[model samples]
Target: MNEKQLEQMKNGKGFIAALDQSGGSTPKALALYGVTEDQYSGEEEMFDLVHDMRTRIITAPAFDSEQIIGAILFEQTMDREIEGLYTADYLYEKKGVVPFLKVDNGLDAEENGVQKMKPIADLEDKLRRANERNIFGTKMRSVIKEPNEEGIKAVVEQQFELGRQIMNAGLVPIIEPEVDINSSNKEKCEEMLKEEILKHLNELNEDDRVMLKLTIPTVANTYTELIEHPNVVRVVALSGGYEIDEANRKLSENNGLIASFSRALTQDLNVNQTDEEFNNKMSATVNSIYQASIT
Candidate 1:
């Protein structure tokens, strides 16, 4: 789960936290975040992490069982074939986990960002098959689209179609607008987000469960724009490589904030640090957000 998903989960009684990456390195880093192999070890370590996180959130005073806890499985484009799809399948098999699949928007592609086709097609096919398999209670969410002016409309249309397919197959669709700090025009960025949400609303039913992803800087500005839209149900906050203090400040300002830390958590844990140092930072970060909602 990314920060936006975490924020959505936080708003409800149940909260979902996603483990960053899959494979050998990911588990070790997750261990630094206070997730021990003892608690989540073996062939089912990935599955165990999902279970443990859910249990912790459910036991927390802030969580409500009436609201469902959503857990997202994120896979980078390169890794999708190896372990990514397998992870999603495992989460779907587990009754308690709500799996959200994430695919990278090909911002790096040179040709109007349309050149990156395989991953998008693979993701769509995965969702289609998951539906065919009757994988109940699992949803699919795309990360924001690429940050390019010419490509924005095309990406939005493509994702909208993806969402429609997912919903038709009995899964929820999470709509995310691409946000890149390098973009020169802030207004253009906002316009792109609004346009995508508007398109989704116009095409889908008003009661559809659609969520939007935004960075902290845009939350205050865009929250009102989305609040009244019946199709929008959740708002997610993307950290965008901001410092912890900056990230926390933005989250505090927003009502529903999801904090995603992939590079930071992975880098910090990979370094040589005492267990105490690891535990302190990990617990502090996780607990601070958990505490923020209650107070």
Candidate 2:
């Protein structure tokens, strides 16, 4: 990513669509879209189908110029280009929507009060490939089901260290510390998450800059300091489990946060709709998300 691309990631209207769920989640999405299972004989085939559909959906005319400034793409889609165009080039080159790749292998089982990201044995290799492909940044996730100080510290520290590695590889990293929305300790967890993130940031050099894709806090606006911090680019918010209206309302309360929503952004679409109907629905959702982002 160049200086201009980096700036696009940091300072856009900041609505990013997350289409990076791993292979395991693809079938569920296909079924929801009413796709037939007879076409694919195995899991790999299923993922291929989903990738083709997802690529087409986002690249359709409806999404081209929406307020969505970036997309977090799964690896399969990233590797497959059309007639010499990177899968995301349609979004980035033509539409100015920067691209980010999901790095972590997903979460391991919870231990010592927090669940950490699954180990990626080839992360350095992966980051190198992503850089070569012109992906603007990377997003990885770790989960916090409850507020445990030791667990929170470990998660934040690990993310920062990995983020440093990513920057060294020449791409920004978006640290995703997600809290279970149903947890009674949501507010406490966010507070601890905030503290640990700040501690790590304070230890980094002045040249370090990264993005955060956090859950919408239980206490809205609690992360304004992060939003305003010099080393932080943009404080992006994940929709977590919130519905569209609720997600929009909660996100609007934060002064500088914007949406990187996945499910919420596509929640109301009817996958069975005709092409014209689908485009109209997709356009409306994009417009709604855009309003929430700018508010």
Candidate 3:
């Protein structure tokens, strides 16, 4: 592991950029960037377009370590090159930001009001590739739609189990069991999810540290205990469909948690914007998120 990168993750002043939209979420992301479905035909072309979008974001003058500490990349993006360097390498060496890779294949159909991650058939190979590319961590997601204790327990267990596998491969894991923000039982479900996560966290050795990405809680500082855990590197909150302003507000209320936002971070950007326009927007976005994270 890169100790310097780990220190930055543990004590950084800014938020993580969730640029890891997969095959399932890529279309929506592109549409938000003003690239409609009709612009790309096949899957290959589709991925290429998305890569271009990511490249534009990474190479932007405002995308350095000033107010952005890390970025999460899709598998395809991890394998691609930017400025004649591997994507992860560019982020770490040139931009002074940590890099993480998204490893889940996607989620299964909902069962017991939860959607567990689909099996990652070759995670070992993927982790090996990530290590080679200088990625410092990994993120996978599962979803909880209700206060079903049984289902929430299963989801948290699955996350920690996969997390251990990633740890064995010498990478930090960001365990994300997202509680559906729109669920009728959103607050109750978050409580249950927290309990389950703590149960599993208590079983780990002190050296077996992990990060967490969760929905912004219904109450401020709901994750204070988790944030203080010795086995937790950091606790971050996902935007979970919140707009940028709302997300920033909620994040500021949580003392120790930071932002790991996707759509909220890129919502103001457009593919056709001039370079100056893009950089200005990025600068504003990064500053807002950084301020919220440090509050």
RMSD of each: 7.8, 1.6, 0.7
TM-score for candidate 3: 0.99
Task: Count backbone overlaps in model 3.
Answer: 0
Who is ahead in TM-score, 2 or 3?
A: 3
lDDT of 2 at 214: 93
lDDT winner between 1 and 3, please give it.
3
What clash pairs does model 1 have? 1-18, 3-258, 3-260, 4-236, 7-257, 7-258, 13-63, 13-64
Per-candidate TM-score against the hidden true structure? 0.61, 0.95, 0.99
Candidate 2, which segments miss by more than 4 Å at Cα?
36-39
Work out candidate 1's RMSD over C-alphas.
7.8
Question: Between prediction 1 and prediction 3, which has the larger TM-score?
Answer: 3
Minimal lDDT window, size 10, model 2 = 57-66
Comparison by lDDT, 1 against 2, better one = 2
Best candidate, TM-score-wise?
A: 3
Q: How well is each residue in 20-136 modelled by candidate 3, as lDDT tens digits? A: 998989999999999999999988999999999999999988888888899999999999999899999999899998999999999999999999999999999999999999999
Runs in model 1 deviating more than 4 A are 1-16, 20-69, 75-97, 103-119, 128-149, 264-280, 291-295
lDDT of 2: 0.82
Please give the RMSD of candidate 2 to the true structure.
1.6
Evaluated at residue 102, the lDDT of candidate 2 is: 92
Clashes of each: 8, 0, 0
